[model samples]
Target chain A: MSSHAGSVQAGQIQRHKLVDRLYHWVMAVCILTLLATSLLPIIGWKFAWLAIHWVTGLVLTVAVLFHIVRALFFQKPMSMVVDGQDLQNLGSGGRPGKYNLAQKLYHLAIAVLILSGIASGLVMLRKIDTPWWRRDPYWFSDSSWGVIYSAHDFVAMSLVTMIIIHVYFALRPDEWHLTRSMFRGWITPKEYKDHFDPKRWNAEEEA
Target chain B: MIVKDIMAPFELYQPAQLKDAFSLLDSFGKDAWKMAGGYDSLDWFKDRIVRPQAVIDLTGIAEMKGIKETPDGVEIGALTTLSEIENNPIIKAKYRLLADAVSHVASPQIRNHGTIGGNASQNARCLYFRYGLPCYRAGGNTCFADTPEGINREHALFGADRCVAVTSSDGAPALTALDAKFVLQSSSGQRVIGAEEFFVGPNVDILHLTAAKPEEILTTIRLPSAWAGKNFYFEKVADRNVWDFPLVNVAAAISVQNGAIRESRIVVGGVSAVPHRLTQVEGIIQGKALEEGTATLAGQSSTRDARPLNYNGFKIPLMASLVTRAVRNATA
Candidate 1:
């Protein structure tokens, strides 16, 4: 039983507990669904996946908002944000994080896609006689809907490309378990250490 | 439960004293592995390449942590995080080049947690072996890297034989160029190994890279003060601008006397199993004027002895270009 359970240190901080894992997976499914639905219109599958897209988009929007609230107020946010140290690491040619280089880029790409999707959705809504928020006179007028629509289309294309890369990289056998980190919440201490601590790992043999 | 069914079931041993740590290590022998930040170790464990029965956690040991400045040089603790080293006022003021190298290690979260000892001792970033294939590094019969038709882009440019995995640490070349020394501690006593001899060739022992005994711990890294006045620069060419491993990197430290290269140490990273010191190139550039043609010739000379694998032929030119750039940057 001791061998099976693995030894746990007394004061070690649980980076990801059961609840965190559940929320992450739930968010992943919702975001992926939203990404697919949002992309269909630009790729000419809009009519075919419209109902599903609309449903998923609405649910994702609500879910993302909820997640943001939870992260900001209810739960501690994961420290994936780019910091001064990260910028330094980037310059050094070392990918130091649970997320790594690709993952950090993926996060930024996703953030841009989400923001663009929301803005575009609001603009397109005006066509259906529903206005979420009227564009301020200082920002843009009805005549600039073409510009907004085109910008949205560009962002949608970028989102598709990012998704393709994301899926392709994720499916590679070496990286498949990275997805499992979201599901399992707790990475094997080995994974945490290797993907994170080169110094510790290197010096350990001597210890 | 079956061994295959166990997720991350490994024992954790935290010895309070260095002697105690060595005793536990000696008892368990090869079955015991040390844990620091667990970065590279955890990944290997996940791949099932390193399944140690006992893990000796080094985090709890006080002797192996912190950074100290001595009149001779800087003595960096094994467990000192890259962030700590990068942001250390002494390191930044005295060893700007080293600080610059550590700064580029990874992301902020990783730098905050990863130690210098771990960075220097990290394993090869060979794509094939990392994916859990029975490559030569895993003591398999055949060498996957040298197959008749395969992707050998990331293979070694030097020390190529049955295996060609390149040394994948960024800090190594920088440290080597600065002439760093590593202090190792075991039950017997203390010993110092030059950073240059730390990495073992793939043909030697596929399992371990350094010559450190199992019971020993890398306790300190000493960088001499003589390396301070020289201008140092690290340049790497990679696939992307941000957060990507270098295809080839050059760490060059040079002392210029009136427009002439008085002395220089050129160390090339990401191209071989160890940070390759360019003695031939340094010899050529010694007392020579730093001109464009000379720089180009120096670059060519540096890469003259390169023994690249099938797919990594581009690295020869890429490394040369990086060397040229590093020379220009250091001289400037």
Candidate 2:
């Protein structure tokens, strides 16, 4: 957040700053575009979807790599990982933290999808023409290429499903404030109380 | 920490005295809820289960916040922090079973905020009810955990209605074993109910755990003197040490003379909506001279009648192990 992004008098906590918000929206657009381009051609719409799909996938891969670096050093990253306590809290109705169990689980899903997509997508790139190189269709054996393609296809399907579920929860009326916070950078006192346990989140407690 | 409200907006009342509190309760009627430490009420408010017109904050009544001794036994205020109960010298020395049970509740932070009365009065920890999923406890006719579709491992082994989910309070079994009585007060009058009878069992009310009326308030809990000097044991089986409700919790207090057992009171929590008292096991041990191997025999004797769901069949042996451990430790 910038210096003026949050103030003590507002009784609000800065959840996401301008940089994080920008990265989030850009990644969302790229993923949505990638999905549309990949799926539309299969459903029989005829356009140059391959070029667009691979480009967007590459962009997403780079963005994720940047995200990993930023999170490791500059961001609050530990909250995104599911710990031993979280697995038990699933059945026990434990209290919420800064990022909830659902958020941590979603992060796990995204990490799996994006990392798999990137690795397999990189392997498949040898089959296609790129700006840097010409297409070498026989770069790998038939069986190895088949395995890479299968993995890429499976991740694409899972990503679609995960995005659908994510959209459903992110748009819920009570959770609207969560989406708003991502856009606006700060949350109301009531929103903070609704979503995060202050003692655990260790955010602005006075709110 | 209370969840931010999702229900209809409510008026908050902080009445200074018991008289003012009762009048607030009477006025609000079914639209009123009495909140002490608010560990339970906050979840209710967030889930939109109890949309109150006015939430009567009972912590304001200074009278309902302490532990004291009487000629008969000890009285614990409804608003008394579980940390206070767990660490209080009087409770640690006299009511070891209750203290032990309180110490295992969730974590230190939760114990600091959760009250003894609030722990008892809350609803069952059914994921269906908590998430407003399709189930009878969620006000629908369907019993999710009763069917093969829902996960039943955490459900009840005894006293199960259509909803098989169990109560999650660790404080309950110890209170029941110690023969505690919950004191209830309303504008009409005051009444005391035994701890076992305080919670509404399966056949009685499937949705709620307590039988208290909407306007009634749980004022204090009274522990009798008879069990104060007895040997006590508390054992809980949970996945983690902190911030997890017990998979099975056992509390037992036995009177042993020399090597022979004279009387026994055993209660188990988290396996059912109501704390299940193992009277048959208690009966079996009353006459026997307890030894190292007696606990193993008693453990096998307990599962003679347990009816577990498909996934919760493992709880039968788990319950036995916990009971055996509790009984063995009680004698030791």
What's the TM-score of each model vs. the native?
Answer: 0.59, 0.60
lDDT for position B157 in model 1: 86
* lDDT (Cα, 0-100) at B255 in candidate 2: 86
Docking class of 2: incorrect
True lDDT of residue B240, candidate 2: 94
Q: Largest TM-score belongs to which candidate?
A: 2
B115-187 in candidate 2: lDDT tens per residue?
9988777677877677666465664545556554667788899866556788888899999999999999988
Model 2: residues with Cα > 4 Å off, grouped in runs = A1-207, B1-8
Residue-by-residue lDDT tens digits, candidate 1, B44-125 = 7766667899999887778888878899988988889999999999888877777888777767788898898898888888
Residue pairs with backbone overlap in model 2: none
- What are the candidates' individual DockQ scores? 0.01, 0.01
TM-score of chain A for each candidate?
A: 0.66, 0.89
Stretches off by above 4 angstroms in model 1 are A1-207, B1-6
Candidate 1: C-alpha lDDT? 0.71
- In order, the Cα lDDT scores of the candidates are 0.71, 0.80
